[model samples]
Target: MLVQDAKNLVIERGGVLNCLGPKLGARFDYDADLRPLFPLIKGNLANAQLYDRPERVQFLLDGILCTIYAQEVVAAPFLERDQVLRFIHRLTATLNDLYTRRHSLGRNHRKTTMLPVYDIYRLLPGTNCTACGQPSCLAFAAALSRGRSYPDRCPGFRQPIAHHAVYPVYDQNGNLVSTLEMELAADADELNRQAQPTREHPAVALLTAREEEVLRLLAKGASNPEIAVALAISPHTVKTHVGHLFDKLGVNDRTQAAVWAHTHHYL
Candidate 1:
């Protein structure tokens, strides 16, 4: 593996990230020189930004912000201890993959800037889908430009992708900044409905908002009582919601419900 150990794990608390959904971030210090892998990362990730001066690459993965410096890696929105381990594993695997294939990949040194917020907003589904936890598409776009958000956070970018097509954007310096995958020729009304928070998944329309919340908690391995406490509801109500969720999702048990939630991205 390119990065085997993180010498230290630093957490940022009550910091700037509180406004961005999480109150903490994770910083991993490593001994590997990540400079050579920047080109491979830039070519792979949609929002990768490589800087030559400091030798770093910043990108988004699974809605989490990641930055790879020459000898360190930082991931944010505060992952749990287990989540941090998984993140490190994935990070190591990604870096190792890039290192192993570096010979076949072309190297690039061009510096690219982030696309304008308006430009990103224009590419969004324009549904004001708050599923990304942002209030609006414009707000999400601004967050994305600042590397605080990712495009896939938009439900419009997540589900029912009937077709795929690349939409390229160039920086002010005429350099290709992003080649985002945009849904093409999709039914507008369906996309809008799916983008709605209460109906993020195609099957979610069959479940109530409370049931959806319960299902998500269950998928996280929360017990009925735990879910009740988390949702500020009674245990009986939580059970009822779980039952309704199972029925609506066509599942027989909690395990099946959890599997369904995961299969439909409710988790």
Candidate 2:
């Protein structure tokens, strides 16, 4: 991966980027004989993996986890390809850092031994905030990998750790057009607190007041013909409201619709 090495690695890939997309996705081909750098990959990326496919690997590039294929890759979008390109540049820079360095790496540097801690620190925020009850972020990462530390100590990682979440979506202007939220992990006994169900749920906001009255009556076992009489509306108008209710509630039958009302306390 020398600066002048044309054969280092240049992938052919394509992908899309939406203003409000979940992730930056791309598909690209790697050389058939991909390097066996699992340890190095893990040290540099928050997420990295080597699978049964000997010639392929997946790793985080910027915010994207991109797959480098040995034999096949799928076309995606423009922004995704750009991220992959930047990833290639970073990989090259890493090679430059590795090659010209004079430091003594542990002899043989086999996977049987732990990953180098300094490398582990590379992926961290580098804040050295001591927020994880460790002297430094590096110590925290090592403790985490070794199972000596739980994920909750890092307020930053707690929610994602609990849910195995994807990062939030971003738009082309780098705006947060959509949000993915994760709640902090609660104590083991938090589930024991009993909570009362409340009526007039948020879904009611989607319907007009008149429509909500119709749903309440429907949930109370009123026939469509009966509802028309009580609401002082024609049967045809009642049927129209029922259809509207079904569309908004996403229910196919009277029973399912009634169940929704009961679950949300609309009844």
Candidate 1 per-residue lDDT over residues 81-106, each given as its tens digit: 67767777777787788788888876
**1-267, model 2: which lDDT tens digit per residue?**
233221333333211211233333334443432353444444454545444323334454544434444433322222554565666566546534543442433212122222233333333566878775565575555544323344456665423322454234345565644433323336534322211232433234335455677789998999989998998887887888788676444455675566556545576
lDDT of 2: 0.48
Cα error of candidate 1 at position 84, Å: 1.5
- State every prediction's TM-score relative to the real structure: 0.40, 0.28
lDDT of 1 at 82: 71
* TM-score (C-alpha) between model 2 and the true structure: 0.28
Sliding window of 10 residues with minimal summed lDDT for model 2: 11-20
Query: Against the unseen true structure, what C-alpha lDDT does each candidate score?
Result: 0.63, 0.48
Measured by C-alpha RMSD in angstroms, how accurate is candidate 2?
A: 21.1
